[model samples]
Structure formats: structure tokens, C-alpha cells
Target: MNILFLTLAKISTLKERGIYHDLMREFSSHNHNVYIVSPIERREGQKTTEKKEGNATFLNVKTLNIQKTNFIEKGISTLTIEKLFLNAIKKYFSKVKFDLVIYSTPPITFTGVIKYIKQRDNAKSYLLLKDIFPQNAVDMQMLSKKGVLYKYFRNKEKELYNISDKIGCMSEANVKFVLNHNSYISKDKVEINPNSIDLQLVTDVSEENKKKIREKYQIPYNRKVFIYGGNLGRPQGIDFLIETLQAKSGDKDVFFVIVGSGTEYDKLKNWFDSFKPENALLFPAIPKSDYDLLVQSCDIGLIFLHKDFLIPNYPSRLLSYLEFKMPVLAATDSNTDIGTDIVKNNCGMAVHSDDIKSMINAIDTLKKMDGAKFEVLRQNSLNFLKKEFQVEQSYFKIIEA
Candidate 1:
């Protein structure tokens, strides 16, 4: 079968290790011809380009900067992406007949593109529901529910859902949220298809090498390093993260590493400058290869979500921590099941994002855990990753639909 996948993520090649890349590679490995329509954001200085890696073809549509920009530009870019992508697809992929169409959510403006493929090729459409929008914007208070913008996107959201043959939600809560709110969506049409990655052999770092890594980063080798590496933005509740850091100012045994760039990077940098907490280190985003090595040296992986989120957000960053055999610590909103799943697997602990004391307590608990218990948690982390987040499972979920 020939498959067409759509995403806003700028995937340059199928070799990149990410959810979309890994999933498309899985389809290609199964002898399917996978074609991806991804954007080449303004920073890349490209008009429209096409490339192929093995069995997969990437059609890079030129697009405006959507992420890490001012609100006005971001909004304009988001609204315009669908038309740009649709035009690119028609120009480049006119001859190719797609058997399956899979796309993710962020901007739900892809109804026209999906409808075109479904009607032109009689393709089965699948919505990889990574995000629930407009309402999420409302939850963050980014947009007023009564505003015209909100109404427009909300209508687009429903149209996208209505066009999908299946809606693969990231968690049970997400599945429930969509069905309960949409009312028009069939219960059976939605299913749990969580964030997943293709498993790779993670190298084991020797104690000597680990020590060198810590020394290179000025991190203490004796302390347990807790690292948070991903987008640092509003949805992550950056203010609460600063408050938590300030609350744990005197702690000497636990080390913190915050890495990643976003609109909130300056806010975090300002806090780091003002406090200069000896236990924490801040850095901008690093290469994926380097980040993986850093994860291997860390003892704990950290996840944060805003307490205001009504939508259940499952961050894909958790998989990297698990792949590195590090137990996780997720401080998230009540609605998200990420924290619950981590604790249930006996791999880590989850605390409500608003509760700084509880987060500090979780750190204390990690510091007190014995070697035997830590090993169990480490093993549990890897086991859970293999069972729940393997990309092959997601491949089957889509193809079988």
C-alpha cells in the first residue's frame, strides 16, 4: 500500500528519530511506499523541495514561521499552512495514488487537504490526534471562547474530525474527552494510539564516561541529576517551574538540568540569572545526538504540564528517558494520565503541577530510594516503553483501520 502522511513537523529525512519519522519508517519497513508532506519553515530559506530516503519521499512545502514567534505571526502562519500544503501536494503528488492518509493535529486547518485525498484517491483517512486545539487555547487563556477566531478554529476542528475515518487519541482520557465533547463522533471511531517511537539500542555509558559528561556540563557527579529537555513554553507552566526551583533553593544533593528553547526560554534564563541556584544548570537546546548522551548520564527525567490544561497531554519526551533506563518524574495537570501511567508502571512518581511541596517530596523520595528499588524502577521504565510506545504497534493501529 502507498501511504501519505501529513505533519507540520520539519522532518528533513526519514533517518531523524521522532514520532513521525519513526512511524513512517515502520510503514516503509513493511514494504509500503510512504510519502510525507512536511513544511520547510522560513528559516530554512527554501521555496518547495522534494527528497527521498529509501522507500519514503518527503515533500517539503515552503511555509511561514509558526513556532517560537510572536502571536500575530504565529496565528497568520497557522491559518495559511493548509493552503500552502494543499497546493504543494497537488503540484508534486498529483500522479501518486494514496491508499491511506494519516495526519496529526495542531492546526486543524487540514480538512480541505484530507477531503481532497479522500475524494480523489478514495483513501482511508486517519487523524493522529496529538493535540486538541482551540479549547486548549481557551484553557491556556490564549484566546477567548466567545471570539471569532475561536469559533472559526473550533468549526475547523469539528470538520477535521468529521472527515476522519478513525481518530487515534494519545490516551484513554483523550479518547474520552473527544467522544464526550464532540457527541457526533462514534465511540468506536476513537482508540488509544499513544505517542510512540521506533526502539533503538541505547549505548551504556561507563562510570568514567558518565563522570566526564557531568564534569563537562559542570554538573556534580555525586548528586542525582534530574533533567528536563523539551519545549519550555506556556503549556509547560514555566512560572510554576521557576517557583519550584526557588522553593528547592537550598537542596544540595539533587541537581537539575533544564534544556530547550521556546518563547519561555528568556523567562527561565531571567530566573536562573536572578537566583543563580547552585543546584541547577540551564542551557539552550542541543543536538538530538548530544541530548541522548546527556540523558544516559542523568538519573531522572522530568515532565511538566500546566495545571490549567483540560486536555490530556502526553509528552513524547518520556520515551527518551525510558529508553535511557532513567526513571521519570512528571508534574502535570490532573487531567493528563502521564503521571498516573508512570506511577502505575512502578517506574516513577507523578505530582500535581501546582503542588510544589509534593514535587519536592518526590525528589526527596528519589534521593532516598535504595539501589535495589532504583534498579527495579529502571527496568520497569524500559519494559513499559517496549510494551506501550513501540512504533510497530502504532503502525498496525493505522494499517488495520
Candidate 2:
């Protein structure tokens, strides 16, 4: 089978360890030829190019920066990407007859591309519904539902859904939301296909190595380290995270290690500069290998989402925490089931993002757990990862479509 994947994520090679890369590798390993159409943002100073790694071929389409840019620039980029991707597919993969067209969302402007493929090659289309678009923008008050821009994107969103033969949502909440909101979409077409990755055994970092990492980062060895390693953007509810740090400033036993960059990075950095919180340390995004080591060294994993969001967000970062056997602490909106799932599985605790007192209390709960109890939670995290987030599960789900 020849699979063509359309995505906004930049994938230079299939060797990289990411949700998409792992799933693509799974398809490739099964003797399928996977073709990817991903962006090469203008900031990368690269032209449209095609390359192959293993059984996958990546057609890197050149486009304006759609992420971490000003609203106007980001909007322009998002509006233009679909056309750019369609042109690239025609130029580079004109002869290839795709058996399946799998794509993810952020910009739901890929209806044209998908329609073309379905008509040209009679391909089966699957949507990896990662974001609930214009609605999410409206939830954050970034766009007005009454505005033209909202109408434009909303129409595109409908078109994209209509074109897809199947829609793979991240959670049950997402599937429900899609069905309720889009009455045109049949229930049989939607199912839970979460953010999954290739499972790797958790290896314990030696105490000496852990000590070296702590020393290198100036983290206290005796303190319980809670690490948040991902985009520090508006969707993450950065303001609440800042308030949490301020509230925990007096705690001497807990340390916060934040590592990520985004539009909200400066806001968080400014707060760190003003408060100089003794219990917290902030760093820009680090290399993946270094970040993996940091996750292993940390005592707790943290995830945050804006309380305003009505969309059910399931961040892939949870998988990282689980794969490393670290218990999680998710401060999220009520709509998302991520926090609830973690607690139900006995992997960790979840608190409402708007409730600072609840978050603080949850941290204290973690702090109070004895080594024996904490070890059980860590094992639960690993167990949840293996059961729910394996790349093979995602591969089978898409193929079954």
C-alpha cells in the first residue's frame, strides 16, 4: 500500500522519535511505502525538497512560519499552506496512486488536497483529529465566532470532515464532541485513536548520573522536582502556571523545572525574572536526548491546559512521562479526560486548572506519598502507556479504517 500523510508538522526524517514518525515507521515496517507532505517553514531557509529515509519519502513543502509567530503572520501562513501542499503533492508525487491519505489538523484547510486525492486515486482518507480548530480559537477568545474569519475556517473544517472516510479522535470526549457539534458526521465514522508512540522499556538512570544532571541544572537533590517540558503557549494556560509557581514559592521541598519555548515563553520568563522563585528553574527548549534524560531524572510530570478550552486536549507529553515511569500531575480544563484517565488508572492526580488550592494540595499529596506508594504509581504510569499508547494500536486503527 502507498500511504500519503498530510500534516502541518515538520518531519525531515522518519528516524526521529515522535508520534507521527513512530506511526509512519510502523506502516513502513509492514512493507507500505509512506509519502509525507510536511512543511519546511521559511525560517528554516529551505526550498521545497524531497528526501527518503528508510521506506518513507518526505516531501518537505516550503511555506511561511505558521507556529510561534504573530497572529497576522500565522493566519496568513495557515491560509496559504493548503495550496502550497497541494501544489507540492502534484509536482513531487504526480505518478503515485495513494491507497490511504492520513492527515492531522491545526489548519483545517486541507480539504482541497484530500478531495483531489480521493477523486484522483480513489484513496481512503483518515483524519487524525488532534485539534478542534476555530472552536478552540474562540474558546481562547482569539477569534470571534461572529466574525468572517471564523465562518471561513468553520466551513473549511466541515469540508475536511466530509472528505474524510474516518475521523480518529484523541479521546471519547473528542468523539462525542465531534458528533454533537457536527450533526452531519455519522457516529460510525468516528472512533478513539489516541496519540501513541513506539513503546520503549523504561531504564533507570544511575543515582550518580541523576546527581550530575541535578548539579548541572542547579536543581536540589533533596527536593522533589516537577518538570513541564513542552510548548509554553496560550493553550497551555501559562498565566495559571505562573500563579502556581508563585503560590509554591515558599515551599522548600518542591522544585519546578520548566523547559519550552513559544509565544508565551517571554511572559513566563518575565515572571521568573521578577519573582526569582527559589524553588523554580526555567530553561528554553533543549535537545530531545537531553530532555528525555531530564524527564527520567524528574520526580513528577506536569501538564497544563487553559480552563477556557471546551475541546478535549490529550497532549502527547503524557506519553513521555509515562514511558519514563514518572507519575503525572495534570492541571487542565474540565472538558479534557486526560487528568481523569490518569487518576482512574492510579498513575497520578488531576486538578482543575482554575483551582490553585486544589493544585497545591495535589502536589502535597505527591510529596506525602511514601517511596513504596510512589513506586506503585510509577508502575501504573508504565502500565497505562503500554496499554493505551502503543504505535501499533494507532497503525491498526488507521488501517482498519
Candidate 3:
């Protein structure tokens, strides 16, 4: 199968440690020809071009810095992606035929591009639903549900849903949310394809290596490490996380290590500015090698969502932690469907989204567990991923369908 992928993310001969790259490699290993059209976020001196690595060929399309645009202007940025990305795809693959077009969504404006390709080549288009929009905006109060803006984007979203050959959601709740919103989409065409963790990359290292990593990061030689790594954005509900740190600053044994950046990065950094959390350490996003090492250095993993996120996420970070044989502590609502496995497998605990007391208690519970119990949790987490989210088993079914 020849697959065409479209996204606004920077994919340099495939991204350093991204979910899409994992699936692409898996597909390519099976002898599927993989061609990707990605967008480059313009930097001061960066170059734009295509690079080939392994079986995957990467092309960087022209894209606007939507980060600098206003809300309405940024919303329109999606359309430009369709125009630029499709142009890049056609210029590169004009004579080649794509068996399938897998369009990942956030801006949700690629419906036009997908439609154009389907008409031009008579191909199947799959909507890989990463972030459900309009509602996610509503959850963050970025857009009002009853406002004129909501009605307009809502229509745009519905149109996209109707055009896709199949919609693959990140979680069951995400699938349910889309079904509830639109009457035209059939149940047969929608499927649950969770955000993935590359199972093959999972590793278990000795305590000696963990100690070296801790020392390298200036983390304590002996202490419990609770890691919260990923995008520092509105949907993540970071204010509550900030307040949790403020309330629990006295806990010296447990260190909360934060990594990654986003629009709300400045807001998160401001609180870390003067106060300088003794119980917390902040690092800008690291490379995949370092990220894998960092996860192993920690004793427990964390997932957080703001209380207001009506359609919350089942963060792929959870799977990454599990892959490293680390237990999880998630602060999120039942809507996310994250904790059921934790409870059943005894991997960790779950607490309410904004309840700092509960979060602290979950941390304490993890700290109290013996090494044997910790190992049990880690093993269970890895076992769960092998059983549930193997990229080949999961994505093949989606693509073959």
C-alpha cells in the first residue's frame, strides 16, 4: 500500500520520537510505501526541504506561524495547511498513487484536501482524530458554545466528519463525543484507535543507570520521582497543577519533574520564577533518548487534565510510562477512561482532576509501596501495552478496514 500522510508538525525524515513515525516505520517495514507531507514552523535560519530516511520520504510544506496569529486568524490557518500540504503532496507524488490517505486532525481543516485527493485518485481517506475540536475549545473556554464563532467552527467540524471514509478516535469517549455531536456519521465507520506507545522501544534499565540519570539531571540520589511530561497547554489544566505544587511544596522526598512547552509555557514558568519550587524541577523538552531515560529515572508517572475538560484525554504519555515499567498516577475525571486499568492491574491510583489533597495522597500511596509492589505495577503496565496497543496489531486493523 502507498500511504500519504498530512500534518503541520515538523517531521525530519520522521520525527525524533513521535507516534506517527512509529506507525509509519511499522507500515514501511511491512513493505508499504510511506510518503509524508509535513509543515515547517519557520525559524530564524532554518531551511525547508525534503529528506529521505529508511523507507520514509519527508517533505516540509509552507506553513504560517499560527502561534503568532489571533484566534480567528489561527482558525483560518487550517485552510492554508490544506492548500500548502496538498500542493506539496501533488508536486511530489503526481504520478504515484496512494492506496490510502491518513489525515491526522487538530486544526480539522484538511477535509478539503482529503476530498480533493479522493476525487483525484479515488482513494480512501482516514481521519485519525487526535484532538476533538470546537468542544476542546469550549472546554478551555477559548470559544463559547453559544457564540457565533462556535456555530461556524462547529459546521466546519461536522463537514469534515461527514467526508472522511473512517474516523479513528484516540479514546472511546472521543468516539462517543463525535457520535453524539453528529447524526450523519455511522457507527460502522467510527473506531477506537488509542494514542499509541511504541512497544518495541520499551526498556527496563538497572537502578545503576537510573541513578546515573538522576545524577545527570541533578535529581536526588534517593527519592521518589513523579514525572509529568508533555505539552504545557490549556487543555492540560496547568493552573491546578501549579496550585498542587504550591500546596505541597513541603514534600522533599518526592520530586515532580516537568518537561515540554506550549502556549501556556510562559504562564507555567512565571510561577517557577521567583518561588523556585524546591520539590519541583523543570526541563525544556528533551530528545527521545533523554525522554526515555528520564521516564526510567522516575518512580511513578503522572497524567493531568483540567476539571473543565468535558471531553478529556487518555494521554499517550501514560502508555510511555507503562512501557518503561513505571506505575501511573493520573489526576483526571472518569470521562477520560484512564484509571480503570490502573485499578484493575494495580499499576497506580487515580484522583479527581483539581483535588490537590487527593493528588498528594496518591503520591504518598505510591511512595509507601514496597519495591516488590513497584515491580508488580511496572510489569503490569508493560504487559497491558503489549496486549492492547501494539502498533502493528492496532493500526493494521484500522488501515485494513
Give the alpha carbon lDDT tens digit for every residue of 124-188 in model 3: 88888887788888887888888987887788788888888888887677888778877788998
**lDDT of candidate 1 at residue 138, scale 0 to 100:** 95
Per-residue lDDT of 31-55 in model 2, one digit per residue for the tens?
9999999999999998999998877
Each candidate structure's count of clashing pairs: 0, 0, 0
Angstrom error at residue 92, model 2: 0.8
Q: Which stretches of candidate 1 lie over 4 Å from their true place?
A: none
Q: Give the TM-scores of the predictions, in the order they appear.
A: 0.98, 0.99, 0.94
Write down the lDDT of every candidate, Cα atoms only: 0.92, 0.94, 0.78
Model 3 bad stretches (over 4 Å): 44-48, 66-73
Task: List ranges where model 2 is wrong by over 4 Å.
Answer: none
TM-score of candidate 3 against the unseen true structure = 0.94
